[model samples]
Target chain A: MTRHYNFCAGPAALPTAVLERAREEMLDYHGRGLSVMEMSHRSPEFVAIAEQAEADLRELLAIPENYKVLFLQGGASLQFSMVPMNLLGQGGTANFLYTGIWGKKALAEAKQLGFAVHMAGSSEASGHTEVPTQAELALSSDAAYLHYTANETIGGLEFDYIPDVSVPLVCDYSSSILAEPLDVSRFGVIYAGAQKNIGPAGLTLVLVRDDLLDQRCQRIPSLFDYQAVAEAGSMVNTPPTYAWYLAGLVFQWLKHDIGGLEAMATINARKAAKLYAAIDSSGLYSNPIALRNRSRMNVPFVLADERLDKPFLAEAEEAGLLNLKGHRSVGGMRASLYNAVPEAAVDTLIDFMADFEQRRG
Target chain B: MTRHYNFCAGPAALPTAVLERAREEMLDYHGRGLSVMEMSHRSPEFVAIAEQAEADLRELLAIPENYKVLFLQGGASLQFSMVPMNLLGQGGTANFLYTGIWGKKALAEAKQLGFAVHMAGSSEASGHTEVPTQAELALSSDAAYLHYTANETIGGLEFDYIPDVSVPLVCDYSSSILAEPLDVSRFGVIYAGAQKNIGPAGLTLVLVRDDLLDQRCQRIPSLFDYQAVAEAGSMVNTPPTYAWYLAGLVFQWLKHDIGGLEAMATINARKAAKLYAAIDSSGLYSNPIALRNRSRMNVPFVLADERLDKPFLAEAEEAGLLNLKGHRSVGGMRASLYNAVPEAAVDTLIDFMADFEQRRG
Candidate 1:
């Protein structure tokens, strides 16, 4: 079987090693005689797997002991609501830095819920190609927490520096959580949809500072209660067991094979640098984001000629490059370089781009 | 590797055939050269998979055209909140029939949300051993809808008859959804967690009558809005793609291998009946619920001497009957006989029970 170079954004590529390991244990997990999917979340075997995943993640990120790691469901989309519900419970306004589509979504969710929300900072003036600098940001005195998207999957924008704020800081880190080592203490809450880097689509990873666990909104669903979820160890209900198990496999792969977040970050930086260098040097390809603020995780590019989009995607697929088509909201092409996407894939992608442009330009 | 009989109630056993197929395709789905878990949810291949799963489910239940089938996450627990928020937009009391733990939780969620809610009927006086009968069931005149648990996983209680009510009817069919042929037209809304009879954890199935789409509570999270979720075809965010794919495989297995729910029901009924017979005829083992209301999907039994509970569970495990310990909330023993728990597994469980009782009763 020929595995192609995949660059799909969110539900993106996973490490081949992780997939192989999961396949090896699909039916019976370590001869337990039951599939991990079939095992009870409360079972000792599954609990071990869950605990190990969290431990590895905490070690990788240097998460403080005061933070509660929750393996949740509903993706980062749900966290958009939960962040406001949990953080703004004490009658304070929700504040956000709108960098791209994802940050806008998070703010939209809060706004939809009728929360008093403010866009403390926005790069909308830059057509979502750049993130607002810390000096340009503003937060209300009543702001309970500052929310931002560390990496926007759709727009290929990322924050180069964490925003320094007096209030609790919340981050939607879906596309870049494990791409580099993080200062976990800087954020009150950091949530990521697990489809990209953690493991699979169903499970979500949430790191909530213990102090922010309470003060949740009144009259919310029990499942939406962070304190309860943390107390129950993310088993407030039946969790996405198999997905969590797979995430554990991924964490193991990262810690042992890839040598943790520092090493992963180095590889990720190099891959993004090579891709950007190729794009900048090309006559037919151009990315809009400012260089310093450009996302290491996602690179969105437009063809020199709009007519070349379809041919480019089709040819790329023929050349064993899959899911290179950009999001429908944004036309052209995108290459998401998540942690699992190897340097070889980026190198291959660069080669393909060079070849495609020469023949088709 | 040997696969033992798994009787977990929520994240219960899956069909061996489905697991085998999933194991075979865990790395490369149909030679697409990417795991289903790795594919973008919006890709043509994944979309086709999502659509086929829904279509197969609709055909299996004979769901009418007016019903929209939603593949969601967060299990039935989250549905507790969504139900009230979606149905009570026009502002009416939520009515409920409380039979067991799951029903109580559903009612509690509505109550916690500070919605106008009423307990139309309850079997609490009977210690939840019997379900409230249709004759005794009542609905408030102001009720937007009447909700009930079709089957309670922990208590091993099930409704023998759907309550004939004037209001829109909502049922949490989590543990018992595909165990038998269901009349899709009977209820206004039906939802089930996928781990039991569907495929795996992390995916939820919701079938909503078309009329219930628009009138939703204001100021709710957009993700919580059924209208938005329905319109997006459950893809407002990246769905639990792998779990959904596995559920699709399960639906196909049900349609082609098991010859639909009617044939499945016959086998399921036989399996449950055989086990129940063994329990009732035994000196030590006894099920609390009335015979008619006892769950066909989950059978919770207790030993005559509570001291023997430990030995019963220990020996059962040694005999390769896994997850025999009952839910911690109601401790004793529970052997969940979901659709995936084959007749052979039941027979083996019964044989193990008899052997244990003969030696230790």
Candidate 2:
């Protein structure tokens, strides 16, 4: 079967090797006589699968021994409410640096849920074309934790430097968790939606320092209580078993196939650099983000003429590139070079963009 | 590859045909060039799959036009919170008819979440051998809704009759949904976890009458708000895309391969009957629940000698009858005869049981 270049922002592409492995084992995993989807989460096979995935992830990220990695359901949207409920239970303000839509949504969820919240800083003044510098960020005196999105998928803005904060550092690293090496000890909690660079949509990855688990709110749902979820090994109830297994496959791919995040970072940097260079050189295309803070994961670019948007997307799809259309709210073109997206996809996209410019510019 | 009989209670067996279709499309869905797992939730292709799954479910259950079917993440455990948050918004006491572990968990969630709750009725005094009758159930004076589990998977108990309540009726139909014909108009809201009879883990299905959508509690997470989720067509966030697609395949299998639920019910009835008859006739085996209230979906039985449990499980696995061990809380054996388990699997299980009894009795 012919596989096309997929560039959707979230629920983006997966490693072809991982997909092939999943396909080979979809009906019966390792001669277990039943699909992973049908197995009990508590079964020996699935538990091993679950543990290995977490272990592999820990190795790849060099996570500290005391951190608990949770494979949970409900993705980042659920985590938005959970982060505040868990971290602010001892009654400190939830602080956020809103760079784009996702970070804003995280802030909004906490605010709507009646949690005391502080918006420390935002790039809103620049139409989210750049992230506020560390000097511009403001942390409240009683901040429980400072939360930020590492990479804004829609806005195409990445934090050039981590916000230095006195409080526990938390991050919504949904769009760029495994793209490069990370200092896990620097954050109290780091969570990512698995749809982007990890595996599938249902499973969310949460890595929390052991000290942070105890402050979870008492009255929240047991599933929402980080302490309870961790105590039970993230299987308080039936987890998304198949999705977790698929994520394990992805972790394995990252470790063995891509030679861990160091190698992945190298490849990702090159891919994004090539695409950005293509846009910068082309007369018909332009990107708005500040060069230093430009996202290596998601790059949103626009054509010279607004009228070319529809044809650009259509022709991109015809040339075997899909999901080139940007977020609906922002009418433009975006190519998300997630970890699973091959470098060849960027090369092909750049060539197509060059050809299109010659034909229509 | 050899496919064995899997009787996992929750992340139970799926229709082999459905699994086959999923395997075929695991790498590239209908030549779309990317796996369904890799597609955007808002993409037209994935949206169509989501809508079709909902539509098929509505048709299968003869759901009322006013009801909204939501394909959501987080299983019944999350619904334990959402139900109270949504239904108790107007500030009435949540009433529950507790039969077993699942129902108790549902009640405990409402209680722990600081909601005013009433224990209307329960069969706990009788060791959960039967469900509390409609006449025995006590609805509170200010009952916002009366909630109950349609079938307790661990306790192997099923409600023989629907409770007639003055207030709205909500049921956690997680284990028994789609086992037979259901009157969708009877309940105000019915929810089930997808792992059992629907498809795989990670997807939860909620069918709620339109009138109940309003009155959701203020300050709950947006993902937890039923009204917002419904209005957005369950697209408030990225859903478990591949799980939803697999569920769609299952719905198609139930409709086309099995000739809908009537034929499915007949087969399921026959399968459950043969197994129960085998248990009743065997000197070595016994099921605890009352015959009429015994779950047709989950049949938890014990051998005459508890010492034989381990060997029985080992032999069962050897015979290619997998996951026959009961819930860890009650350590005997349980055979879940979900719609996908097939009559042949039941026949094979019965023959194995008879042969085992003859040798060990």
Candidate 3:
């Protein structure tokens, strides 16, 4: 099979090894005569898989004992409302720091859930080109939590420093999770959709400090209650078993073959640096985000000549690069370099960009 | 690899052919050089898979154009809260007919969602031995919708007759969906978790009438909003793609090899009849549910000599049959003859049961 470099934000590229493992085990998981998809979540085999996945993830992130790891469905989008519903308590508010599309959508969902949300910081006026400085944020004293998106996929912006706040810190780390090391104890909650850097689109990973779990209203649905799911080992309901299993495979692959997050961070930084340097040097391409705040995971750039946008994408596709188109909200091109992305793919992308630049120049 | 007949209640057995196909295509789906899990949901390749899956499902069920089929995550458990959150607008009451575990769980979730819910009828007095007769039901005329579980996996009960109600009828067909034929027009909505009769556990299927969708409360999260998901073609959020793809394969299998729901019903009936006859003929075994109300999909029975229970399960396991253990709530054995269960497996089960009974009689 011909290989293609996928630069899609996510449901993005996964390690070829993980996919091959899944293929080998798809028909008869560990000689159990059933696919992992066919195994009962309650079975010892699946329970072991779920537990190992959680353990490996905790080890990778250095998650403290006080934090619970949950594998949930409905993506991080569901977590937008779920965070407020579970943590905002009754008649409380959350302070939101808007960096890009995901943060804005999360706050919007929280607002609908009756939270008194305040935009503590925003870069909307600058087309989300920068993450606001600490001094620029206006966090509320009465806020139940401070919410932010760690990496903004659409705007190609990222926060370099964790916010030091009196209130609980909640972050949507969907785009950048597991691509680097994280201090799990620094936040009250860190939630990520699995598609980008984890495993698949359906499963979501939520790391929550146990203390924050008690804020659920009595009326919250059991499935949406983080406390309940955490207590039940994320099996309060039948989980997306196949997704969980695949995620477990990815976790194992990440730990054993791909190296731990510390090693992973080095490769990630190198890839991001190479691509960013290329964009910065090129006369034909420009990334709008402020340099210090630019994302190491997603690099969104515009062709110097806006009229060349369509042809640029067409040429990129022909070069076996796919999903380079930017989000509709931010028109241009976006190359999402998640953890599974190889440095070689980045080299190929850099080569393509250079060739395209020389021709366009 | 040695094959075993897996009898898991859910995340259950799939046809061997389906598993083989998934294994063969796991790494490179239809020559796309990407696992279905790694494909962008918006890509033409993935979209074609999604569209074809839906088309196959629509064809299998003979779903009307007015009824929108949605592929969602969070399982049917999420739908429990979602159903009431969307349909029970302005705090109106919804009627629930509780037969078993799933029905009770659904009711609990709906009630927690702030819906004024009434238990229209319940068979808890009989340990859910039978579905409540339509004549004995106490449905409310003011109910926004009447909800029922088509088949209860845990209690092994099933509603034999479709209730003729003036209100919109919603059935949780999680354990029995696609196991038999049905007129889609008879119900306002039908939902099923994709484990038992469908493909896997992570994906949930919802077939809803177009007109019943408008009652969504404005506060509903986009992921939980039936109208929003229906409008977006279940892509309102990132769906469980691999599970969805597997479900499509099962749908195609159902349409071609299994000869659709009508043919499925005949085979299922024969399988159920064979198992029921063995139970009835054996003096050492019995099923408590009334014959007419007994679930053709799940047959739960107990050994007359309770001491033989452990040996029965152990011997069955040795005989290559697995997960025949009944739900903890009801201590016995349950063989779930979902659509994927071949008649030959049922015959093997019946023969085993008879031989055990004869030796112990």
Candidate 4:
């Protein structure tokens, strides 16, 4: 079977090996006479699978003991409301560092839920070209938490350093998470939708400091309550069981075959460097983000001649490299190199970019 | 390859043909060179898949043109809140008919969200042995909607008739949906979690009337707004793409292979009749539910000697009939014969039950 390189922003590419294994085991899982999708979530068989997925994730991220790992639904967007609902106990101001579209949308959702939201820093005025330096940010002392997107999938900007602050740090790491190494202790909460570096779109991963668990506002539904999900081991209600199963397979694939997060980080860095170098060298293409803040996962670049954008994407599709179009908000080209993207695929993309540039010149 | 018949209540069995096709196409769907899971939700390819799924569902249910079908996330539990948030305009009362655990949970969530909740009728006092009669129900004239569970998975009860109501009729068809023919136009809204009769756990089906779209209460999150999801064709957020895809496959399988809803109804009736007849004829086992209101989808029964429960379940497991234990709230045995359950599997279960009874006697 032909395997095209998928570069969709999310509901994104998965490891080919995981998909093959899932296919082989689709009829009956481990002699259970039932597909993993058909098993009861409460059954010992499934409980073990869920627990192992969580354990593997913890090991991959080196998650601190003080944090609780939660597998939740409703995506990262839901977390926008859940984070404020859980963290903004009795109501207080929250600071936001706006880098791109995602951070803006998240802040908008938080504000609707009654948080006194403040823009600590914003790159929107500069077309989201750079991440704000610590000195340039205006964090509030009275803020319940400081929110930021670690990597902006749309604008393709990424933070190079953790913002030093006294307030609790909450980062939407939907795109950049697990693409490289992370210091788990640096933040109060880190949440990522699994579609990118993790697994599928249905499961959302939230790692919260244990202390943060007790601050949930009462009257929130049990399903939205972080404390409730954490207490029930993320099975507060029936979870997205099939997605969780696939995620388990993904975790296993990541740990054993892909080499743990440390090795993954090296590969991710090399991949990013190769693509960035190609874009910088080409007269026909340019990535607008400030060099220090350019995302290692989402590489958004525009053709020097804007009229060639559609033709560029069509040709790339014909070459079996798909979903290279940028976000509608930023019309150009984007090649997302998440963990599942192989080095050979990156080399292929670079080669195509060079050939295209030469042909256009 | 050996395939064990799965009898899980929800997250239950899927058609074997669908599973096989999914497995075959898991790596490269129709030469797209990417699994359906990897496709972008907004792409034309996935859009066609989503639209086709909705069209197939519409055709199967004979859905009215005045209604909208929404594919949503967060399961039926989220709808417990979303229904009130969307339909209970200005804190209006919504009448509930509590057949079992699901209705009570939905009512509790609506109450939490500030809806004036009233119990029109409830069979909980009789241990949910039967659905309430029309004369016993007391739906208010000012009620925004009247809610009921069409089939209770936990208590094994089902409605014998649709209640005549001036206000909108809303039903949670989580377990019984698609197992038999349903008149879609009779209700203002119908919702079902996909785990039982549809496909997987992460996706939910919502059919709402056009009139219900105008009742949105302010301050509901856009993601939770039924109107927003309906308008966007459920692409308002990154949906549970893989779950939705699988549900589409199940819809196709049901339509073509299972011979549509009428055929499904005939098969489901036969399966239920056989199991109920066995329970009635044998002095060794009894199903407590009232005959008229008993669920065709869920068959809950008790051994004459309650002490044999453990042995019965253990022996059943050895015989390859799994997950027969009843819900913890009511201890006995429950066989959820959803649409995917075959006649032979029911026959196998009956044979085992008879043999076990003879040994005990």
Candidate 5:
């Protein structure tokens, strides 16, 4: 089978090794005579799997003892309402920093839910090209928490540093978690939809400080109650077991084959630098985001001539570099270099970019 | 691989053909160079898959054009909250018929959410062994909706007939959907967790009448708002793509191999009858559920001696009949013959039961 380099921003590429292992185990998981997809979530076999997955993820994030990891459903979209419903009880409000599309979306949901959300800082004026500096933030004194998007896939902007604030920090790290080393203890809650760096869509991994789980508003949905879900070990209902198992395999792959997140950071840095360097040197292509805020995971670049965009995508598809067409919200080409995407794929993309530039120059 | 007859109530068995197709396409789906799991929900390729799945489901159920089908996350547990949140507008009360464990659970959530819920009918006095007759239902005239569990998986009881009610009817068809024929026009909404009859866990299918989608309560989460999700074509968030794909495969299998719901009903009926007959004739084993309301999908039976329960389960597992242990709440043994479970498996189970009874009699 011919392997293709897939750069889909979310529901994106998975490591070939993990995919192959999943395939081998699809018919009968660990000689259990049934697919993981067919196994009972309460079965000892599946319980072991769910436990190991949480443990590995906890280790990878170096999550503190005070933090509770809950595997949930409804993607990051649910978290938009849940975070506020679970945190901003009664009359409290949250401070939001809008850096890109996802942040704007989260803010919209919080507002829609009647949460008194305050925009502490925003770089929308710069077309979401940069994150606001610490000085630009005007956090509310009575705020419940500070919410931010660590990396914006659509706008290709990333936070280079964790904000230093006394308030509880909540982040939508959907596009950035497990891509690099980070201080897990710095935040009150870090939630990510598990489609980018994680194995699959449909599973949202939420890590919240234990103390924060008790603040659920009276009207919050039972499933969205952090304390109840955390106590149930994220098995409040039948989980996406197959996705959870695949994610466990990914965590294993990252630990063994790719080494830890620290080593992963170095490799990710190299891939981004090489690709960005190629874009910078080429007169035919350019990335719009500021250098300091450019996302290492998702890099969106525009063709010198917009007319060549369709042809460039077609040619790239032919060359087996798939899903390069950027998000419709951001019209250009995006090459997402998640941990599953190897440096070799990035080199191939760079070479292909150079060739396409020469042919269309 | 040694195939087993798994009797897990939820996260249950899937058609072997569906699992095989998933395995074959694990690395590259339809030669698209990526697994369906890795495909973007927005891509044309994935959109087609999602559309086809919904289309096939609509065809199988003979669902009217007036109904909107939603592919959602969070399973049926989340729906326990969502149903009331979406349907029970301010000060609205719903009539609930409690036939079994699931109905009780849904009722509990509705009450917890402060929905003015009235118990229209309950089989609690009968130990959840039967469904309430139409004459027994005392539905309130001003009730927003009448809610019922089509089949109670834990108690192995089923409503053989749809409740005759004036109010819009909502049914939890989790364990019974696609196993038989039903009039979709009679129900205002039908929600099911896919793990039982569909494909996998984490994907919930909601079929709501177009007219009912308008009744969104002020506090409903956006993901739980049926109208919002339907308008978005269930793309309000990233769906469980792999589960949806597998469910589509199951739909195809039901349509082609089993020759639609009518034929599936006949097969299911036969499987249930054979097992029930065996239990009735044997002095050593008996099904507690009344024959009239006995579930055609899940047949829970208990050994007369009770002391042999553990040995029976252990030996059955060794013989490749797995997960027959009943729910902790209703302990003995449950043989769940979902659509995926072949009639031969039921015959095998009966044979094992008879042999075990003879040996221990």
Candidate 6:
């Protein structure tokens, strides 16, 4: 049985090795009589698994001791509300740098939750094809936290450098997190849903600097109370156990097979460069984003002839390159080169794109 | 290769056939060249899987056409907050029948969210070993809704009859739903964390009558707003795709191998009766709850001598009867006989119990 290279933005491809190990242990994990899914969340076995996943994540990211790593449920979309609910206390202004659809959604959720939001900066004027430079950033005078998307999965834009700021910085690193080395101490909070680089779609990883945990709004839902959740060790609710286990395996794969985040970043950059070079050289395809801001994670490109988009995607699928469809907001194709997406897949995708352009040129 | 009877109260055992099927499809679901976990939630394939899971569940429970089923993230604990946030609008008085730990937690969350709560009835006075009789119920006239725990996982207590009520009735069926036939028309909403009787953890199933969808609090989190989630077809955010698929497979198993809820109810009765009979007839073991109020799902019992508890649990584990330890609060042994725990396992458990008692007594 051959495995296909999947290019979904989130809920994307996982390391083949992770899937194989999980499949082998589907019914009995580590000689335990029951599958991991059947184990109680509070059991010694599951507790150890959860703890190890967090520990490995902390090591891979080199997280500071001052930060608390929380394994939470609900996707990052829930964090959109949770961030404001837990941070924007009375008389605090929420600041947002809106770059793409995800940032816009986060800002909207904060606003909907009755927080006053200040738009610190925005790339909407450019049709979300670029990111605001450090010089362009504006901070609210009384901002509780400045929020930004590290990488826009839809628009294929990524921040080239961390912005230097006074207030606490909270980043939605959903797509780019684990693909590159990060300085955890620079940010007050870093959150990513598991579907991309981590594991499956249910679990969310949250890293909150210890100082940021106490400023929650009054009457906040207990589950969204970062301080309370941190206190309980992210076990206030029954966590997504299977996703947590899979995430641990992915971390192990990252640590042993792929070295660490630095190695991951090197490989990811190489894959992105090869694919983007193919797009740049071809007269039949184009990527719209600026070179400096192009995301190494999600690479979106369009066919020169719009009519060929369907045929390109269809033929790509036929070749076992799956889920190459871009987000609806952005038409054409997107190749999400997450950590699990091997360099060979990108090579194959590049070759396929070249062949397709030749056949349709 | 032998699989054990996993008696975990939550994250309990799943059918061996289901697990094997999942293993077979881990690398490629239906030759799609991707695991279900890797599929985009919005893809046609995933959309079909999600829709089919809901449809199968609706059919299995005979849920009314007017009821909308939402597949959500976060376990039942999150629902404790969401139920009130969505149902208890301004000036609303929430009523709760506090039976056990879960119900108490729900009430506490509702009050913490600034909603006034009325204790309609409670079994805490009886150490949660019995359910409140019909005459003891005291729902307020001005209450927004009356909520109850259909089954208490820790207490080993279950409501034998649905309460006759005037206010909208909400039931937390985390430990009981789909184990037997449920009259969906009788309740305004039924919410269950999938870990228990459904599928894996992290996926929550909420069945809300159409009319209750619109009465949400003004500042409800977008993900927690039932109306918006139902309208978006549970794709408001990325779902627990694998769990949803696993649940669909379980529904298929129930329909084909088990032959629907009526047949399930019959088998469950026999299992519960046999387990309870063994405990009662044994001189060394006894159940604390009133027989009429006992749960057919979770059977908690205490051995006469506390010193033998460790040995009993250790020997049980050696014999492949896993996760039979009682809840920490209960301080006894619990044998959860969810649908997946076969009768043969129960017989083995009873025989083991009898053997242990004869030797230790």
iRMSD of prediction 4:
1.1
Q: Give the alpha carbon lDDT tens digit for every residue of A98-210 in model 4.
A: 99889999899988866689999998778799888999999766788999999999889999999988988999999989887789899999999989988888889999999
Candidate 2, B-chain TM? 0.99
- TM-score of predicted model 2? 0.99
Model 5 misplaced regions, further than 4 Å: none
Q: Write model 3 residue lDDT over B1-361, tens digit each, in one string.
A: 6668887898889988888888888777777667788888988899999999999988888899999999999889988988988887655688999998889989988877777899999998877887888888887767888999998898788888998888889999999888877889999989998999889888899999999888877777778888889888899878888888989999989988888889999998998988899899889889999877899988899888889999999899889788899987778899988888788888888888888877775
- Please tell me which model should have the higher TM-score, number 3 or number 5: 5
- What are the DockQ scores of the candidates, in order? 0.83, 0.86, 0.74, 0.76, 0.76, 0.84
List candidate 4 stretches off by more than 4 Å.
none
DockQ score of candidate 1? 0.83
For model 4 chain A, the run of ten residues with the poorest summed lDDT: A214-223
Worst 10 residues of 6 chain A by lDDT: A84-93
Model 3 Cα lDDT, one tens digit per residue, A1-361: 6567889898999888888888888877897777788778888999999899888998888899999999999999999989988986755678899887789999988888767889999988777887888888898767888999999988889998999888889999999999888988889999999998889888999999998888986777788899889989999888988888888888898899988998899999999999999999989988988888989999999887888888889998898787899987778899999988889989999999899878875
If you superpose only chain B onto the true chain B, what TM-score does each candidate give?
0.99, 0.99, 0.97, 0.98, 0.98, 0.99
Q: Tens-digit lDDT track for model 5 on A1-361?
A: 6678999988999999999999998888888888898899999999999999999988888888999999999899889999998998755778899998788889889998877889999998887887899888899878889999999888889998899898899999999899987799999999999999997898999999998887888866788999999999988778899999999999999899999899999999999999999999999999988899999999999998999999999999999999999898768899999999988999999999999999896
TM-score of chain A of 3: 0.98
Candidate 4 lDDT, B9-118, residue by residue in tens? 97899999989999999999999999999989998888888989999999999999999999988889988988888897665698999988999999999888667889
Q: Judge the docking of candidate 5 as incorrect, acceptable, medium or high.
A: medium
Going through the candidates in the order shown, the clash numbers are: 0, 0, 0, 0, 0, 0
| Tens digit of per-residue lDDT, candidate 2, span A1-361 | 8899999997989999998999889888899999999999999999999999989999999999999998899989899999999988889899999899999999999999999899999999999988898889898898899999999989999998877888999999999999999999899999999999999999999999999988987778889988888889999999999989989999999999999999999999999999999999999999999999999999999999989888888899999999999899897999999999999999999999999999998
Candidate ranking under lDDT, highest first, comes to: 2, 6, 1, 5, 4, 3
How do these models rank on DockQ, best leading?
2, 6, 1, 4, 5, 3
